[model samples]
Target: MDEFLEKVFEAAFKRESEQDENIVRSLPFFVAALGLVLAIFSQVVVRMPPVGTIASAFLYVLFGSATAIFSNILWCLFQLVRARDFKLPPNEERLLEWADSLQKFHKTGKRTRKAAEELAIVDVRRRLVEAYAEAAVDNRKSNRHKFKYRAQGFMGLVLLMVLASASVGVIFFDKTWRISHGQGATAEAAFPPPHREKRIDRTVRDGEAQASGAGSAD
Candidate 1:
């Protein structure tokens, strides 16, 4: 019975370790996703039309808003990858001490060989159960936190992708507007064109008047 219980405890501990390893393995994939999104976002921004009109202004604000949201999501992913404390097996030295104590107790004529063996198994089993319980509880909590963060990161990435696609659409629309308008739209286009004074040639007018006067005198 003790041996069977020990096996069960060992299995539980193995499961917790595997869970931790799985989370660690998933980190690289998340990082790669973030990098990909960042690259695409850069392209979108670089190709965005200049921000002089109402549409371009709205696009700038949308990009800024998307960036802020994405940053929060990135922080969540960072938290998921950050180091956390995990419980390990009972110390070997401590287990050895318990075994030695059991031997000493047996040598004092307090127990027969069979009884000593049974007691040793019972003591070891008790220690294993305690360690397994503590580790299982602590690891479960850690795993829950990791799972929560992982879910948040995943959802955040999805939202970011949607926003990025929308931004691309807006950029395309802006480009189309610029193309159809001859690319000469200015911020001041909202106002009328500037007025200029029409200049007159006073010297030419004065020479014409003098020639007419001399012809009349002749």
Candidate 2:
């Protein structure tokens, strides 16, 4: 009985320890990924022009994505803290004492195992198993939460990329429009209209006739 209980406790402890280690290792990756996303977002914002109606719509979407990413990052941080502080049942000391007693009994062979002590040990083992089971469930839940947040963060990143691309396209389109309009204005400035040219010719003829008449009179 003691051997079996010890095996169970060892297995449970190993499993929980591995889970903690995994969570600790994964936290840095999450933080790094989020930081990269934020940096890319900031670069995109810096290059963005003043927002018009269409651009405003894109900005709103980008804002929502940013909010989601940050929220997920906070959640991941909270989970990381919780994982770091994970512990076994509070009666762990009592269980360890029972295990020690059982060990000592097997070694000395001087005293017979009391029925009450055996029952108590059995109860402790059962509680430990239950605690381990609960911990396993919690670990699984935490993993699912991590996966969900990661997916959301990636989705936000995709949305940000789309927003950036759309903004660039709009900027290019506006620049082209301005260039075309400027070229049209320049062409008009370089060439006078037909009506203006005709008016100028008529004024010159009148002035020449007036000058000739004045000279004849003199």
Candidate 3:
């Protein structure tokens, strides 16, 4: 019975380990893709038209979200590195010792084992299995956390992409509107003409000349 249980535990552990390995292997590719997208979006933002306060605030939010997602990805990578080195519980060593003794005794064909010894072996095996099951549970919890972080990061990336795309659309739209309606000429018209300033200066000089003539005549 103990052997069967041990085999089951081993199989489950192997499956989990393989799943974790696959996740770790795929993370680098995901991180690289996200980073590339972020870089492209950053360039787009740089080329975007000047925005008002509201749009600038939105851009700041997008920047912060992207930075947080990048940080989360980095943290997940670090966690994967740490999780690769799994450590057994301290009591597991004693359980292994007991199992070894039982195996040796059986191999020697010893038929005079005490009832207490047999019970102790059974208890140790049960405890060992329990310990492994607990460890597996912990591993599963960690995996869930990894998934959650990745999901959040991806969501943030998507949001940033959407915001950047919208900003780009606005820029193109504004440019088109300005061109279609001759807004550029209107903007030029908004400024006072240079000739007006020259005329004002000429009027001031004429007034000063008239004043000087009157004083000379007096």
Return the top candidate by lDDT.
1
**Per-residue alpha-carbon lDDT of model 2 for 90-171, expressed as tens digits?**
4767778877776565546554557545655676677667766666666556656655655555565566456555556655
Better of 2 and 3 by lDDT: 3
**All candidates' TM-scores?**
0.76, 0.50, 0.57
Instruction: Tell me the tens digit of each residue's lDDT in model 3 across 1-218.
Output: 78677667766666666667776776776677677667767775754434453445565666676667667766756665564445343465676787777656654654445654676577666766776666666666667676676666556556656755665665566657766988746634454356867887899999999999999999
Pairs of colliding residues, candidate 2? none
Full-model lDDT for every candidate: 0.76, 0.62, 0.64
lDDT of the structure predicted as candidate 2: 0.62
Instruction: Assess the local accuracy of residue 72 in candidate 3 as a C-alpha lDDT between 0 and 100.
Output: 70
Which candidate do you rate higher for lDDT, 1 or 2? 1
lDDT of 3: 0.64
Worst 10 residues of 2 by lDDT: 183-192
Name model 1 segments beyond 4 Å from true. 181-218
**lDDT tens readout by residue for model 1, 101-143:** 8867876786778888777778878888878878887898998
